[model samples]
Target: MHTSAANELKSESLELLREYYQFPSAELRNRLVQLNLGLVRKEAHHWVNQCTESYEDLLQVGCMGLIRAIERFDIAKGHAFSSFAIPYIRGEIQHYLRDKGSPVRIPRRWQTLQHQATMLTRQLQVQLNRQPTDQEIAAALEISVAEWQEIKLAFRNRAPLSLDAPMHEDDDSSASLADLVPDNRYQSFQLAQEDRIRLQQALVQLEKRTREVLEFVFLYDLTQKETAERLGISAVTVSRRVKSGLKLLKKIMVGSSS
Candidate 1:
């Protein structure tokens, strides 16, 4: 169907749904799905581009989520149905990708965590007007620091760097960076779960200022100058504190492992 026709159908369906939403009526439910099927197709297109698979399979999976969303939607919520339905549709597609669409399938649990992490990162990024620290995001989500690290790892797994894409230099004719770069995950860890927990525990033992300095430096990837500016301290102090915190964190991690 044409874009205009799909949009018109969506608008008409939403209007009907807003006025009369009957749970048991097959006709009403069917109409809503038929109209909103376009949404599923649209969202599936996004994944299909990234994924090497037939679009039809993903479209079918996304439609299942759209149907479920229609069944569960509450008109009284006073929210746009499109906004609410997109997540459901996206989640379904991602879940399907994790299961069968991708060669290296991640577990369903990690997939859900990664999805939550992405949404929370966006939310906190907007609220803070800068990238949020893992500590801040963890506090807001009320998840353990280790769990947040796991989410980050899971998110990284989904990110694929193209071998044909240029890396550093702007020159397009240069050799692709993939030849020089090794995609190794086993070297140390992209931050192991054990390390995170030990580090979190060590953080609690540090002085408040020391903990804050480390948070700014590592979690937010702030430089000594930026940390000093934000915390109203000298660069020397931020440097000293970060140095001390790292020493302590390293000791704690080693202790925990032993």
Candidate 2:
């Protein structure tokens, strides 16, 4: 934004905040959120290079924080709204990344423990002439078994594995995470059955003559001449009914879904 536009917006925001402080209506709150949306976008942009989460997702989460800040802000305190609101926006995105295992926001204490655990493992390997078990590690660290387990689990799961990651470590193996996922036949069968039920329901909505014509031609897999003979109608009439009935069924199905 240009300097002049920034000044104008700051001026506008000040007046709106003063008005909102006194009136406290939904309309004023909405306007305040709109005027300050740039704050959310700015905070979200700061996280774009730091994590794998999409910018739009970060922006959406930051907007929630911005809304909370606006609702609780005290204009009487003389604090700059930008300064006050930035923490809320930044904290929300940090929390989202932490929960999503972005690995940057791991607690300082846990990070320290993880480092200690790594060093301790190498020492114990030489002393015992073998890898230390979880129990031995926890005892050596003077922490509970559960705490040691948690630390190990968090460190292991902190980063997402790409779907392109190899499923085998062999030099010539071509398998990947994507290839390991099972696409079973039962799920496909269920989807097909659901579609058949929908088609049957749509068929029931047709007029009696039209329904009979469709059932004979489609369900029985009969030719138009055979369908017409069964229905006692000319082949031309059967063709017309089939076309009109299909168009109406398409419309009815679309309307029902909507």
Candidate 3:
């Protein structure tokens, strides 16, 4: 799916979450969990190669964390759910690994500190208008520079260097570690799950016919002619709708972002 379409789905999930938050229900919670299962799978796979645990075991454990995040997430916090939930999901996997005597254990305190540091780094970058120095991050975390460095070093040591490690292919060409990982449909779906709330709301402002045309062409992945057939309009009309709809969406999205 195109990135925009994937973003649309994510926006829908967020809208559902908002509704679920206002009127808590077992069914809505279950649906929210189902919608976000990809996040669990992504985090679980992240640890799959880092430890000796089976993927299935890690996945089941990760789901528990996802459930906790769904229950605890505050829509009014103005934080992205994925950002808030990743720590929970990762914590669960890490706890499972530690409990089961995984060899690559990093202290829980250090791990928690590392997550705090990451969040602080972003805030500091914006405030400083540049990448924040390690000292600045350390201060924000209320830790000495040496302890912050130790936390960073320990977190690095916990994972094998694979994500961006260099590799050689059969033809002797070099590639990044990410290129070596399988880009399966599941990963594609995960990509689609990234948030794009502005675009989603902008789409909602479109006329119903235009919205339907865009959905059929983008979300449903249909050809312009096929979309026209389904909507009982001429192909030319579908093309016009697609163009005008996108123009309007871009305007709304850009204005909102600014």
lDDT of 3 at 111: 76
Best model per TM-score:
3
lDDT of 2 at 177: 22
Cα-based lDDT at residue 102, candidate 3 = 86
Local accuracy of candidate 3 as per-residue lDDT tens digits, 112-201: 888888788778867875556668888899989988876665565364333232221113224232232324553432211212223344
Q: Which sections of candidate 3 miss by over 4 Å?
A: 105-258
List residue ranges in candidate 1 displaced over 4 A: 1-11, 104-258
lDDT (Cα, 0-100) at 192 in candidate 1: 33
Cα misplacement distance, residue 67 of candidate 1 (Å)? 0.5
- State each model's CA lDDT, in order: 0.63, 0.68, 0.67
Superposed Cα RMSD, model 1: 18.4
Listed in order, each prediction's TM-score against the native is 0.40, 0.39, 0.42
- Write the residue-wise lDDT of candidate 1 on 42-155 in tens digits: 777656655666799889898877876676566664556776677678667766776774753456776776677779878886777666677887787788887787666445
Candidate 2 lDDT over residue span 38-156, tens digit each: 99998787567556889999999998878877876677756578866776776677668877887454466778988998899889978876556779888988899988876665554
Clashing pairs in 3: none
What lDDT score goes with residue 62 in model 3?
A: 89
